[model samples]
Target: MSRPRLLLVYPATHKLGWVKRFQLPSLALKQVAAATPTDWEIVLVDEVHEDVPFDGNFDLVGITAMTHQAARAYEISDRFRSQGKTVVLGGIHPTVLPEEAGRHADAVVIGEAEPVWAGLLGDFLAGKLQPVYRAAIPDGGQLSIPWGRRDIFSGKQYLTTQTLQASRGCPYDCPFCITTNYFGKSFRYREPEDVLAELATFSGKLTVFLDDNILGDAARAKPILAGMRGMGLKWGGQANLRFAEDPEAVRLLADSGCIGIFVGIESMAGEHANHPKTGSRYSQAELIKRIRDTGVVVEASMIFGFDDHDEGVFERTVRFLEECKPSLPTFHILTPYPGTALFDQFDGEGRLLHKDWSRYDHGQVVFKPKLMTPEQLYQGWQQARWEAYRWPKIIDRVMQSPGKPVHLLYNLLRRGGISRPQ
Candidate 1:
């Protein structure tokens, strides 16, 4: 009998050209590949780099996608299923709307796939494949997942293939976020030793932790940072700004070869300040400066189009970034993604423009703004983006950055993103 083969796909909306080299390979697919029994051969096709081998003789086809990739993903699924291959669809989009996805797949993994992947494959081999496999939402507890299979990404040119997740889930449930819905309401960490051991296998110094917040649980994060102190790995990851409040934690983070960190500022509106995550505007700037002072680049992100935001939001946000002077400022239009409170509220109010998932990406405005037109929100986003990347502003930021070249590279790359004219 021929050995079983699995083809995992990372669908892309469009070709990325040289930009694909800087992107990270899909960690979600890697984890799925890891959970596959050793008996099966796994092949991966990242649509951004190469075309999917639709005619490949594979026993099982697995495709993962985020909200914006849903259209392309569904198209790919339909094509594969038409060829008589058993298909599975899972990811943020499908996990939120499994019924819609079920219409296109032989099976849908509702949550983390590791819990049911083996069983699904078994059922398939036994010719008893089911339509749905839902894993329970992980709440408070340690998270144990197979170290994602890095070999599956072999021969692929990514910025760094040494990416892993040390933890999952977030404690905070922001109205605009779906994290709590899809990944429970608490931080579930892995053993520090396991994370360190995985790092030991990484050959190079370039590593990235694809966690919701690497420092969400400072207690759990410290141990991993301590172990990585001597690893000599220059890494970057996202974390809540609150982490810098503890001086010792910042020291440990700096010593752990963390070259940069991305933190969410969300919005500059006063309503946002009341939240513990944002705190007061005065202190948020202080915290960002504290992290940047440690020779670590801090990429502070801001989203426009909160209910409290008005026509002046774009200028006000640009002013705040001027004061904070973070190493970089990332501006986004607030996106009401499915499976979030924001989406529900928008839909109930009939504020959503349409159910076109492709335009739901943060780069585009997909809802009517409470205080401004959708076109205004989009134009403001574009204007603020150009304002932040202006020659003088970029120079000011790069001057304070520890790694000047890296800072400039990031600035250029972010600026290169094409913006549709108003």
Candidate 2:
């Protein structure tokens, strides 16, 4: 007469080292828990912070993975299957490469799990679980699902446990992005009032929006921002630079308790201009200033190792970061994830160095560079992070960006003093 137990896991992408210890709560696993029936006893495991309970008694085990975490996911899946527990794998990497994932998991859930989760669970309990369950892309209105089970993350230490998503998918499809492939090419937003209602349930003063692009659609974002104005919540999310061109949208974002934003500048020298969605009418400097003028911290994301980049890119990138003085900046080596256009292009050109999934983390270089050696590209990326997070540079950026000293300081302390890979 006991209820079936469901174990949900988020696999760690790398071995836990000093540098790899920073982890945010897994919103995906919590969302999966939300979809599970209340009759089941659900336990969530984030391998980043805690050990996976391989020997735990569970009727079913569900694991989610990204590209870098695929290896760890497979290991976890194999262990659970060995214990006679039915294992299911889902998320971007498994969804894109279902066949490979199926080799390990008893069942694979492709795409969003919301639509098919109940059916899948019913079939499993009936002792007739299918090999694959594909969920149809739901409409924007369907995104107004229940909030994630935040209680699962209760005792864990995290930078921010309050993560919410108002929308799914992105309008822009950059070659290096896997989001469009997984979420589709259109923006699907939950109703503003619904999103506001969910936000009201959180007790934390800070929240992190998990939207791929929070401002993907200005009209949809406006109401959400307006709703947040009186909520007394400080939040941050990723957005495109175009958000600055619309004066009203910028004002709404700032007034809506937006303490920080992550903007993908990608490259400083207009290298990404050929991509329609990345092309900006305003210069990077202008966009950063406009966002900062609203008293919102800007965490500019820049990628190195583009085909157009040369050895001098590191110095030029550091110079731009200093000049623009965004509250915080992140540098990453361009990674070609499995389902992206960049992956296809690199695979065809015989430029991919190896199929090692662990090295696919954005910080590592996995492909041959067009203009520089792979080592040079990786070192350049490390140099950018080194220079950007130095005490002097952090102090200068903090002074340039008006308010959100706490936001700036948190970023600085998190990134500062981390030794770069040789």
Top TM-score hit: 1
TM-score per model over all chains: 0.97, 0.94
* lDDT (Cα, 0-100) at 143 in candidate 1: 87
Cα lDDT computed for each candidate against the true fold:
0.89, 0.84
Instruction: Give the per-residue lDDT of model 2 (tens digit) for 1-422.
Output: 59999999998865565544355688888888888988998988888767999888889999999889999999999988888889999999888899999999999999988878888999999999999998765433436567888887877777767898988987567889988766777888888988998899876467999998899899999999998888889898999887888889999999999988998888874664555655567777887889898889888889898888999999999998888777788888899999889999999999999999978998789999899999999888887788778778777877766675775666666586558657
Query: Can you tell me which runs of candidate 2 are displaced by over 4 Å?
Result: 14-22, 137-142, 420-422
TM-score of 2: 0.94
Model 1 per-residue lDDT tens digits across residues 80-173: 9998888999999999999999999999989888889999999999999999999888878988999989899889899988999999998789
With a 3 Å backbone cut-off (N, CA, C), the pairs that clash in candidate 1 are none
